[model samples]
Target: MIVQHNIMALNSYNRLGTNNNAVQKNLEKLSSGYRINRAGDDAAGLAISEKMRAQITGLERAQLNAKDGISLVQTAEGALTEVHSMLNRLVELGVESANGIYQATDRDKIQAEVNQITEEIDRISKSTNFNGIKLLDGSLGSSTANVDGGSAITATQTDATQAQYVGANAVLNGVTFASLTKGDVLTVTVNTRINGTDSAQTFSLTYNPDKHTQLSDLQDALNAQIKEAFGADFKVTDNTQVLTFEAKEAGADKAIVSGMSWTVKNYNDSASGVVVATGSTSMTETKGVDAYTTVSGFDGGATALTKTSSSADVEKNTLTINGQKFVMVKDKDAAANVNKIDSGINVIVAKDLDQAAADIEKATGIKVAVDGNNLKVFAPKGAASGGAGLTLQVGDTADSFNKVTVSVDNMSSAGLGVNGLTVTDQGIAADSITRVKSAIEKVSVNRGRLGALQNRLEHTLNNLATTTENMTNAESRIRDTDMAQEMMAFTKNNVLVQAAQSMLAQANQQPQQVLQLLR
Candidate 1:
């Protein structure tokens, strides 16, 4: 009706533009084979999909890690198989030497073989390695000490408890240490003993998304802040994606990480690292160690120590030292509970407590139970093995619940207490056989532990496969395009696009017809 404002044509043009946009969106979804390619398509779905994708990736990597752990266990167990054979052979030689018919000269040859076999045992324990990591040594296994039953000739067993004076330590694995993002600010409150006085200090670090994107970036930055605030005696380390803090000086009440709290703006924001720890997260810190509370012997009895004194007649406490003939002298009011003497041999006393081989607990049964209230210490208890050092990360989570740890006992000749055994004499040779049998039991126990580790890993692999499949299925449902459905949508939108184009053309013509009014 009016030349100045072509209202009909404007309506067609607007409809055409809107229809074309729908067509473009349809093409994007169809060609890309994705239901939601951008945030505009489905913002909530995108976020959920991304988080699921990350979990899948982590689960996959965890499978590989579990595989590596199996390999390590296999290598250690296989080497132990050989050790088992050598130990059995040692027992055979010992029994042969024990025969009364065998003369001293013949027994010497047996002794020579025993020495070589023992040396070879030591060699295997020292040199056995898997990927440059020692397997049969005391390092990878839990620490065990020989619990002597009072006398040198008594039965000995392995005990795995230690005093909690190693260090104040803990791993804050609850937080996905990689997740700290830009504008994410966290404060660490540290409580420590300064000159035996309890002191508290707080330090905070802010994450800049522009700078820290790598896992190491987050760890290093946070660690630096912790170190600066915690001072020189403490050290922070990241192991297997775990943040561990330990004191360089070993003792009770050394350090305590009182609390850790964070404030994050976005889940991932600008940080390249995936944000895992979410929502006002905090870790409750506990003290790591305890002082000299109660000491129990290896045999579930009271602990005893033999002190060698310059003055022999110091109150005459008759305590036998390793079955060696020694006179025990009382130096104090304290006395041991168990009496293990032919007559009246009392346990030794101190003041006269000069000292012996600091035994590293080889000749003593020193049990230290931790009192959690006193100090911050992390004392790893020893086990049937000499040390438990290897930790297996079998799950995607960074917590103790998701880990499997194994103990590889030391299988060396000395470790089994056969290094000193001799096959040259009949009585001694018989004793050697007894000891070798004991050694065999130790190797068997070690192998059994490794076997358990392998089996557990196998089960873990099965679980991981199942979980990965399920998660992938869930993510696909939320993300992947339904091709048939998309096709139907595409067809409908394409038709609308064509219709809009034709209408737009007609709209232009309608404006032209208005000019014919001038004619």
Candidate 2:
């Protein structure tokens, strides 16, 4: 018997402490309603659960984001609905004016109504707000383009091809105007003239005169002697033996009014009846009238005059005036004229209004109207209303409407309205209404798509909830302790502990028996 070592007691105590720890852990699992409360409980389960929880939270938030997206789309669609309605009303008005029988006054009254609706459209485009952001009027789009002279201009166009010219003279005479073409349209105009006295009367050529060969080509030129005497400004052209000089710029009187005049003998056809002189005295006539100045008919048999003297009539030679005989005239004027007023409802798509306006002006040769969201430009007047001015529908992207055509004037010869307007044959308002209806349909389709997605998300959320519950149950089976089973084990261990104590006492009695021998 070694009193130094209490081996049995130590063994029993260690076993008790370990059993108590097991009991405590089971109790914790049952009470906490979780399989893994701490990393020590089930490190792998804890890690897996944490990741699942994060994903669940993120999925919920994603669902919320999708809902918000739908709302935005719906808001835009509703605004467009109103826009469509307005367009329908305008279509009806267009039909009312299609009847040619209506006088201008009647048209003006209808125009007033049209103008009012236009104003309303502008108001809507400017005022429609979605979560503090504008939706329908293209407010949230922009792009930057650089032009010459170290300047940058930002612009937006429904057509990607539309470009903004930031600098001066970026394009001259319609060639590649910029170092980077970037799909910009350029129109160039050149103003030049022909001089006669300096050389000979000459005609400038074009690429295809066969098509427009008969077009007039008259220009101003300087006379060799008078050009040197008076300097660069003394330019002249002749009409039937009469000479007229033009100044660099128009003033009180052209130079011919104050300059001396003479006629070479052979050049004056008055000597022959080939030409007649009515308003002159000698071989030369100097009424000092400018060319193409609308002149009234002759006063009583005093007919329109022509040069009548020709000094070298007997000799045959190529006719020359100021050196040469023929002068080519080219007409430089506006191609056509038609005025259009748009509400400029799409300014939001542009980086800046001024640059956008400038681009439209340059490309279309029309004045841009920036009064509101409606972009308006004067149409080529006399444009066959049929193929001329079409209001383009801008698509979702910046380039959607680039190629869309707008030919309002050419809607129909006989028209009540294109879509559903009540006008005579040939009204454009109806067609515009049709277009708006199409847009509405598109918006409706998109909304339907959102609705479907929302349904899917709801279903997904339900499935995720069910899966999370089942997964928790499975983990519990592996890591949780049943309280009833743990209580039964604790009761058994308690009985054992008491029995062991009793046995230990009995063993002590046995040791006392040995003590009797010592007595």
**What are the models' TM-scores?**
0.57, 0.41
CA lDDT of each candidate?
0.54, 0.34
Q: Which lDDT tens digits does candidate 1 get at residues 337-437?
A: 21222222223332222231122122222332223321111112221213336888878879898888866766776566666456776766776776788
- Cα deviation in Å at residue 307, candidate 1? 27
Model 1 ranges off by over 4 Å: 146-386, 515-519
What is model 2's C-alpha RMSD? 24.0
* Model 2 residue 455 lDDT score: 58
lDDT of 2: 0.34
Residues 1-519, candidate 2: write the lDDT tens digits.
544555665665666566566657666766775657789987887777676565545444544544454455456556656755766676566666665577667766776766566556556655666567554332221111111100111111111111111111101111111121222221111111111111211111122212221111212211343344434354455565444444343353433222222112112222111111122211111111111111011011111111212212100111111111110111111001000111111111124444545644433233444434323322221110111122222221236422232111111101111111222223333334444444345335433543564455455446545655665565556556666776676577666656666655554455445466768
Off by over 4 Å in 2: 139-519
User: Which whole-number lDDT from 0 to 100 does residue 35 have in model 1?
Assistant: 85
Q: Relative to the unseen true structure, what is the C-alpha lDDT of residue 446 in candidate 1, on a scale of 0 to 100?
A: 85
Which 10 successive residues of model 1 have the least lDDT summed?
A: 287-296
